[model samples]
Target: MRTPHVVVVMGVAGTGKTTIGPLLAGRLGVPYAEGDDFHPQANIDKMAAGIPLGDEDRRPWLDAIGAWAHGRAGLGGVVSSSALKRAYRDRLRAAAPGVVFVHLTGDRELIEDRMAQRQGHFMPTALLDSQFATLQPLEADERGVAVDVSGSPEQIAARAAAALDGLDATAPDAIAPDTTAQAGPSPL
Candidate 1:
């Protein structure tokens, strides 16, 4: 039997991580985890007040998500996280060594527009800039793929599924090439 990998659907706040995560999880027949649920109330309050969380503020949240990811390792699960920095991703990898990322990429205007349309979300549109500023694209060595957010959630999830399908998830150092271009138009 093939080993199943835990997928982390990652990107900036408004790039649709929440929407696509469950879709991808459904496609893969795995459970889904909402990363924001891992955040403490304090962190939500901070972001709600337009404050960007510092590394110290994020560590606990990341660890919480990591712990969940660790628990789901090999069992196959999908989780969502902004995972905007290399260090944050590294922290996740430390806890769940085989977790693969599905980065949702899109233009700022598009993301901002989507953020405005969304309701009852604690993350304010004001924090979008900070999210983009903090984002670090996955490196060549990273075992993941970047999918463009230009299409519908179903389309985006389909693209991610296709990209992930091509990856050798069992390989310790499987490198998922940047498939953003193939997924759709450049979101850069």
Candidate 2:
């Protein structure tokens, strides 16, 4: 609801953060910062070597990204990050309070296919598994929404903007709950 909202596009690799971040920023009429840009050369090299980045490797990067996000938001700008952990999210929150995170969730196979098909990216497909394994999905109680990456990039960006702007009136019928006790769990 605040001006220059920071909407983080968080998820494991291949979740479309890089693609959607700029589009979302454009929609919001603000600059979008990619979290990957904060990564040092060493981290990039390790990822290029098909090695997963551990917490130690990510701490400085996350801090730098968070600092940038905080600074930008303070100056009426929006930023995006692939913050994969609750702790990392907390760090960003600490830096930019009330920043809304738009979590992009997808299946391993789906995202793996995306990574494999991706062109001119330093992150190799081999590191996808490690990212998935280390990823901690955002909590349901968090101040953010989870959107499944089951549609086109445009659809995903629209959903993110709608959620952020409160312009989406119709509820997403992505799932239907069963009222009858006999009915089993509704398909999510």
Candidate 3:
């Protein structure tokens, strides 16, 4: 078998990172690490106040997430992170040299609607516009795959897993293995 890769499920909030990350991890048979859990308290507080996080506010959190992902790479574990900007993703790559990113794509209206309907989350819809504005779409050299988020959670997870595993993107026969049921908390 090919070696399992550390996959970063990246996108703006409400693009299903939290939901899909765990399922992907379950299929890959690796630990799920939520990138949000690594955010600094101040960054979380800033988002809670409806302020978009600037690069200054994000640096430490990115470093932490990158370091964590690096550790996972060393262990052959799977990890999920937002990694919205190209620069941020670059930094993460520098930290975890061989990580693969799965960029989740969706319409702004759709993402905003999902964010509005989500519960128990500190990220406010007020920051959605800023996030959309700041998002740097995956560049050609990023070694990433972009999956549209208009499908069911299972579909999204399955696509990400297949891409990382080097299977056909739409291989219906290659169903994702269930990892969440056996793994602990998920991170994206």
Q: What is the TM-score of each candidate against the true structure?
A: 0.89, 0.82, 0.85
Between candidates 2 and 3, the lDDT winner: 3
lDDT (Cα atoms) of all candidates against the true structure: 0.86, 0.73, 0.76
Error of 1 at 32 (Å): 0.1
RMSD of each: 7.4, 9.8, 8.2
Candidate topping TM-score: 1
Clashing pairs in 3: 26-179, 26-180, 33-187, 34-187, 34-188
Candidate 1 Cα lDDT to native: 0.86
Worst 10 residues of 3 by lDDT: 178-187
> Which residue pairs of candidate 1 clash?
none
Local lDDT at 123 for model 1: 95
lDDT of 3 by residue, 1-188 (tens): 15555778889989999899889888878888888898989988889999888878878887887778768764555556677787787777767766778888998889999999999899999888788888888887566688889889999888877677563342342333323322322222
Instruction: Give lDDT tens digits, candidate 1, residues 48-163.
Output: 99999999898889889988988997688999999999878877877777788999999899999999999999999999999999999999878788999998999999999988
Better-scoring candidate (lDDT), 1 or 2: 1
lDDT of 2 by residue, 24-142 (tens): 78777888787788899999999999888877887788778767766775454455566777777776666666466788988888999998899988999888777877778878645
Provide the lowest-lDDT 10-residue window in model 2.
173-182
